[model samples]
Target: MPEAHGTDEVSDARPGPIRVVIADDHALYRQGMAIVVELDGAAVVVGQAGNGGEVVDLCARLHPDVVLMDVRMPVVGGIEATSRLHAADPRIRILMLTMSDDESDLFEAIKAGASGYLLKDLPGEEVADAIRRVHDGQAIIPPGMAATLLQEFSRLSQAGSVPEGPEPTTLTDREVEVLRHVARGMVNREVADALGIAENTVKNHVRSILEKLHLHSRVEAAVYAHQQRLVPPDA
Candidate 1:
């Protein structure tokens, strides 16, 4: 793992590498992550911070492409940190990396502007890939978590915490079909294969879906699809 720290080395570095910041309370884990993310040569660890406060500072100075944040920390938690950093700069992609699967944390992370929520148990390679995907503007909710997230949203809606929005009537039937596949955690290529359509067509459908629903990313679209019950309840 690269022992290099300091935003100076990373801040002025050219834009080729997907600059990353690994924020975890554990020193060992931060070192491990620095190694794993750079293994593929697609990303480089620009900085490491042990707490949320430091993360915010590093992000301000380094301006990384993605931040791997832990939920639990001494001074500030990941959710609050993500909220602050995201509010400051909406473009910085924050991916929550934690051991907790608590629905509350997951929902809160999403609410705080996280691009993705990933369990720490995921393989390092998967984690690296997730960072890249998030940087590329894709949302990375694990398959198991997706259903639970929908359930959480349903409960919140039932409690009237989430204001009801008008149904998205603008989406065509095929777009709706594509949405269901995406909500079920299928990528664009996967959705295209399942629907027997071209990948570019699926991309167009996704773009249209996001635009029609006024959604930002596929993660939000998936959540919207579930909240509207666009797919079978049993699904």
Candidate 2:
């Protein structure tokens, strides 16, 4: 039973900062991370947990906008926790912030429905900015790891595990337009610029696309679009 200690007493649903829940096995690291994430006021740590079950329980109650989850934790582990949380609510964004560079962990995190996978060696400011991007529906995978993900995708394709038709989707033309850009790894700002729409409008479209497709993150959306052959053949 992890406790939500040393955090602001803000309401669970707020308009100010992005509500966040930090879950890691280490208390010192979790506390230090909370400080860094809240330093610029772009995000707030509404709760803290040390294990998967605790974070699951906290997310159930706190309903944080984003979860900064670790890959490996005792009791429940991060992958299982992410799967459970994503199953429960695809709207809550989850980011894997860990020291593990294992490609399998990266694939599992994304497969378990995490919105983003990031390493711990990044600067604190960049980490904080990642929270913002994840909150705004962008997938943040480091460059080196992006290639790892591509390799994984290629492996899956070579294994003949990828379905030719995948599953049926009900995305509209505009949503298809947006999904293609997302699958191409375009952020919301870029998508908005390409489509000649407001950035916030692109955000709304992304939210709608996620909700309609029952997808969690832009990464998942990207995968979905690829399976549907929505992007260019080169993509």
Clashes (backbone N, CA, C under 3 Å), per candidate, total 0, 0
Q: How many backbone clashes does candidate 1 have?
A: 0
Instruction: At residue 16, give the lDDT of candidate 2.
Output: 74
In angstroms, the error of model 2 at 211 is: 5.0
Tens-digit lDDT track of model 1 for 1-235? 1111100000112358889999999999999889999999999899999999999999999988889999888899999999999899877888888675554588888778887777777777787777766776667777667667667776776577866444778889999899899777677788989999998898888877877776657766766776787876656
lDDT of 2 by residue, 1-235 (tens): 1111110011123367899999999999999999999999888899999999999999999898999999999999999999999899777888897775554788878788777676777678788877876675566677556656755764675577644432535767787898888778777788899999998787777877777776656656666676676765468
Stretches > 4 Å off in candidate 1: 1-15, 100-104, 164-167, 170-174, 184-186, 193-195
| Candidate 2 Cα outliers beyond 4 Å, as residue runs | 1-14, 100-102, 157-182, 186-212, 229-234
Error of 1 at 36 (Å): 1.5
- RMSD (Å) of each candidate, 1 decimal: 6.6, 6.7
State, as a TM-score between 0 and 1, how close model 1 is to the true structure: 0.81
